[model samples]
Target: MSLFVDSSSIRNFLRRDWERAESQLGSVLSDTMVKLGAVLNELANILDGDSAAKYLPLVGDLRKVKRFINAILLMQIEKTNLGRTDFDKRDLINLMLLHLNYPGLFRRIRNLFAVEPA
Candidate 1:
């Protein structure tokens, strides 16, 4: 019947749309992972054989950026329902979210955003 055919066509279109969206999200996630890895590497460099105490401030800044990166990845993973496969259990954002979901956890994470790098 024509009605059945139309319904099938609609389903196919929706499936294609969903696939496209998923593909785009995967690309974004991949990009974010690369950026996060770079930031982590920089942090390692700062921690390695620090000759000056001033480097401590820079280390803190790199850490904050890392947190921001994790937050973004966590949000995307949650939206795409890909957290389990995309991120490990020790993921910073995952831990942060876990704490955030609890009551009165804002005091901890809120200060993180308030901090400004020198």
Candidate 2:
């Protein structure tokens, strides 16, 4: 047997891969949203539910973080909805994944709380 593949065969192979990856990404996004929601809920419970609102800027920051992640998820979810990957879709996904990276987000927020008001 010859070890050569035609262009169409390669295209089909890549297309199937893209579709599978998209399905997996959709599951990942859904699971991430669920876990994030649970964490936020747990924080609220620890803060005493309705009283969590009394925390002012901390509570505000929590809300902002939820919105931020939702936005990122929606962007990253675009390729999954299309069920395919292309140059454009991959660009958005890559950037969103970077945004989801650790410590930068945590450190930035931690610094805000670390300030000692004069």
Candidate 3:
């Protein structure tokens, strides 16, 4: 018997995967916010000295980055849930790439969330 893959089945599989990814991305955003809050609390405890001076500006910059990330994540989640066939996927991919490639921003974020070595 000849075998053929149904087109609708492929579409359904892709849709499910996309939904799963969207959910995971939302979870990641939530986790990132929590981590940022923790970092903010730590920074707040250091009210003076060189560390505070250095971190104060970094935290400001990080806040701006966080806002940008929140917007991107919200846009992606909305687009994915809406299943807008006309939406250009490339735009979402480009935004993700831009965030990843943004000089020092990604590293700073990572450091904020990093677990210190014992």
Candidate 2 wrongly placed segments (more than 4 Å): 1-28, 49-54, 61-118
Residue clash pairs of candidate 1: none
| Alpha carbon RMSD to native, model 2 | 19.8
At residue 61, give the lDDT of candidate 1: 40
Better of 1 and 3 by lDDT: 1
lDDT of 1 by residue, 55-78 (tens): 333223423433444555565533
What lDDT does candidate 2 reach at residue 36?
Answer: 38
lDDT of 3 at 95: 42
lDDT of 2 at 61: 41
lDDT of 3 at 111: 78
Candidate 3 local lDDT, 1-118, one digit each (tens): 3123333332332334333544676665555444333332333344233454443333234334344345555544532432346644334433443454564775776678999989
lDDT per residue as tens, model 2, 1-118: 4324443332343334333544676755555444334333433343454554443233234334344346555644433433253545334433443455444875676677896878
TM-score, each model?
Answer: 0.26, 0.26, 0.23
